[model samples]
Target chain A: MKKLLATILILSLVLTMAVGCTSDKVEETKSLKVTSGLWSRPEEQQFIREEILPGFEEEFNVKVELEVIDNIEKVMEAQKASDEWTTDVVMTHSGTMPLYIANEYVQPLDSVKDSLDITFMDAFESATTQDGKTYYLPISADVYLLIANQKALPYLPDGADVTKLTWEEYKDWAINIADAEGAKVSFPLMPIKASQYQVGGIGLSYGSEFPMINSPGMLSAWELLGEMVKNNAILETSFNYDNPVEQMKSEEAWLTFYHMVPVGDIYSSAPAKYVVAAAPAGPNGNGSIAGAWGVGITAGTNNKDVAEEFIKYLARPEVLYEVAAGTGGFIPPVNEVIAQLGEEPKDIIMKKGLDTLENGVVSGVPASEYTDWGAVKSVFDTVFQEMWDNDGELAKDFLDAQQKELEKLEK
Target chain B: MKNKYKKWFPYFLLTPALLYYVLFWIRPVLRAFFESMTDYDGSFSLMFFSKVINESMFTAALRNSLLFALISVMLQFTVAFMMALLLNKKFKGSNLLLFVALIPMAVPPAAVAILWKTGFSTFGWINNLLITLNLIKEPILWMTAKGYNALLFLILIDTWTVLPSVMIILLAGLQNLNKEYEEAGLIFGASRFQIIKDIIMPILKPTIITAVILRMIAAMQVWMISVMMFGYGRVPFLVERIAYYTDMVPMLKESYKMSLTYSVVVTTIVMISVMIYLRVNKKKEKEVRI
Candidate 1:
């Protein structure tokens, strides 16, 4: 009887201690973090460090920490886990955001829907909305175009123009440039799976949209690219090239398509800056393939309200222009704020990128996870790798087999 | 009472390790195996393994991984065995040379890879030295080399990093060897080469097999070097493909099944190899006894 009473006393004491230890600690000062895979050196990342962070800290009396996670895989893995995300908000390029939305990894911004003051372009409309919910908002624009060194401009065909050139004309121009000085054209590759994001635009010009990789239009595009490699018009797979800009400076390669951000920097370092032109026209049309980045609160975040407030603060027209200018993107949706930048001749890169965005018809498909477009991207890269291995030869049977593989992915 | 307490103490001490083994190792393996047999919504399905085999990259990844393993094992075993034979001699600075060789073993694999990358870049020492020697007017983009050339440098880098440990295993085997047999052979007027070939090699067979198998397994898992140095689709390996499916591609369920297939294939190869080695060794031992 004595032993039973003692045991009861000990159990009660332990239970009381456990309850005391479980009390929640009050969080006095609110803090939030933003993580994104879209971040790169200079421009927008710089603007975020110098302006947005300080502005938020001063205005809301809240501390904001910015993290640049270059690896999208890590960010996605975190989204897969049930634990609270390391950051309250996450951002990715428009092409990738759909996966997060489809997985329900991000919270719908329905409550602050009216607060989205910026009007997005028609192309972005599908990118931002899904199943009647706004999973992403436009932040900045990144457009791909042909950036040629001034020295190579003389080699352009007499009738051909940079603003409007057929894919064949573009090839002729590249071949002509090489013939002039025996220097190869630079075709930039991101070296890994990330190449899919950049090269998907090439397929866009061929009328290959999301889940439409195996189309005849894409076959023509890859064949043309293969011919370029065979003709030595483009850099070989084993070339001593690190980046397009560096190759341009060395006079090894003076022509290729690249994001306007790095192409604009040639002005400061070299005797002349690059001329950004629309990407070569495919059989369908010549709309520049554009990628954008935007911020959205994660569904697992506890501080949704604060994250929304921050997103709103960034979404304002004035703030957007500042960020767009810094990121060298033709600001969100449209360039309504380009005039606000006063006068900086350096804005030409953004202006040219904007011109392409404005003029060309966007032929790419809207981003959707259901398409499992990533598999299609892998298949495309595999073809190119095979071509490189076979000395620029792609067998018809191989192409057919690959297309059949892609056909199976269609919904 | 004290005797009863002592009897229970050993079991109490083993509790944490047993729990760790079950929770950390056994549970995850079981979970992965089970998950592979299910669809995304957790319904039981075995379609994924066949789907993995059908994927375009599977054949290439498996072929590359097996080829890499074969090449790496042969090169490392030859180099390490030669190194062990040399270091076993009574020579000046032998200990210091061993110390220098073992330094790579202390560094992490990722760090070692990064160091090699820095040294092999276009502007790095390797290219610069080659240029200085007039080996070639232009730099070779080592990562972009086609076919076997790209793999050649990767094998060198992997061997450089792992050679020391391989050598150590063989050296330990040499040290533990009884010198009496070699002396007996010498007394019988057996030549040095004859003694080494007929006796020393047969005696060291188990150690050689152990080192070769360990190296082979490590080689089969060759991924970071290939992925980091070359890239996706450039030099795909089995493990690298699994990473691409799991981390880069979004087909989570499909990737799980692919991994299940991958693990099964690799595990089967290792098991078969090890079994063959043991069987051969046992037969040889029986013959020697007879």
Candidate 2:
């Protein structure tokens, strides 16, 4: 009995280990493998699987398998040298699109582009095209917005419209709230949350380009943020805050700036309890980062025709609207969808984002310009830390010193 | 033929383990070493090593990792030893105490981090409790800790989560300890502290060494709790840098090489640390023998 038990245990262990070593066999069915970094939430995935892909699957008589990966570019990069292409189509964001195009991990979608009769917005068109070739077709655009609890309405600066407040007015508003209550104004300062975009948005409002590390406008932006920090206007827990929705829900933070989806999440839950508006303007204009997610075919895909068909299907006006609605609230880049938008709560939120994009000084994805955007984000994080550490008082040469660091990264 | 088969059966049993190690362990280490030494384009290059050395956070990560290992291991061993000794003694409700003490061992590192993170936030439960107790007029900004303060905060949280595991190991050792050795010390009129110092400790040396070495290695690789609590850059560690390279920016051509180099560096450090510790332990053993 002892010997039998030992043999069984060893056999079970070996079998478990062998399971991982076995290669998955390729299936012979008519299938489309779509790897997406967007719409990854469980509910969103369910909606895509049940609501969106069934129509395509039924029409083409193919099994549309949707796999949501957080960093599809890294996966594609790993698979770049391999000939066994597992992914037929990729849906990823604008920041990662540059890497795919530069590495040629994705194929040029010019044929798909020429096939479509619809007109894409000029900015979206320019973003998707590189050296006269369209790499991906833009699906939807998203921008950050200001979300405030209704309790904070009383604390708005005198004569300051919540929608049209300038940076100085916004700072004063924060200061006013901090004085009456605890520090409640927050930003998602955690590294993983792409908080650098928020900093760049402020810098753009101050008349600098996105990721202009040592630009004079960036200096002013930093100084403004430093002043807020000095006044204890920013939440002390912002460093741990990757998303302010929970804080808002807990009433730990009453005012914040965050991505449209999370903001939509807050508003959609309790529309009467919160106010959503366009991000505040700076001296130049209401500067905001306009990010878009696009769909493209991987370079090594065997099913190019199917991938192209999938992209075209994703581009339909109604299809785009459904995607925007299904994946929370993102502004569709198509003109017809924007023109035909309704008065629903989510539509209002997307309209606010579009309002900022139309009226603000819009910056393209900063990663598009830099070879190492992570390094750029590091610079911002370091400066933010220094600003916080010093009670928001920057040394005269601090920005310049950080600029030298940025230059080193560029080299 | 049956005698030969019986003689070779032991070797046959070892074959599976040997193959597992060669395939899963040796292969990855060899691959990482090879990858770290080569350039992206496959040329032999020391550029990655140079970059890692000159990297701004490299020194800080090294210092923090070493300091965390040293401090946390020493602290954990001392507290866990006391708990083990206490639990070894017969007392009422001792089993309940042991059960409560072992509760934290069941919580995973990630969950431990979240539990403490929520507690340590500015307006979190800790502050709320303090406020409710009338201990302060306002909430303290526990999350704003920087430099050594942040390191110490992580150490405290790490200690709370890992203390139970270390104590349980020590408790097992103490339970297995021979009673006659302590009885002999007691008959000689030796005090409790002296009995523990002279008799119990020397006998439990092997077990203590095992527990300390295990805890020290884990402490050296501490990254998850720090990252989960403070994010990437705030509380940088050697393994955290590896994660940053591989997880944060794997798309960069240089990130893979940099992470592999960091892995090599970390492995070298851990190996050297364990070797030095064993050498010291051997020297101490020799001294006692002399």
**Chain A TM-score from candidate 1:** 0.80
Error of 1 at A341 (Å): 4.5
Model 1 steric clash pairs:
none
Candidate 1 residue B233 Cα shift, in angstroms, is 3.3
In order of appearance, the predictions have TM-scores of 0.78, 0.85
Backbone clash pairs for candidate 2 read: none
Model 1, range A232-340, lDDT digits (tens) per residue?
6776632333346656655556787766665655533553455666667777676455777867888788788889988888877777776766564444554456555
**Per-residue lDDT of model 2, residues B1-290, tens digit only:** 99999999999999999999999999999999998899888889888999999998999999999999999999999999999999999899899999999999899999998898889877789999999999987878898888899999999898998999999988999999989999999999999999999998988888899998898889888999988888897888999999999887665668888999999999999999999999999999999899
Query: What overall lDDT goes with each candidate model?
Result: 0.71, 0.86
Per-residue C-alpha lDDT of model 1 across residues B7-71, encoded as one tens digit per residue:
99999999999999999989977787776677778798876777767877788877787778888
- lDDT string, candidate 2, A196-301, tens digits: 7887888889999877667888888888888889999888788887778767877788888777877887787788899888988898988888888889999999
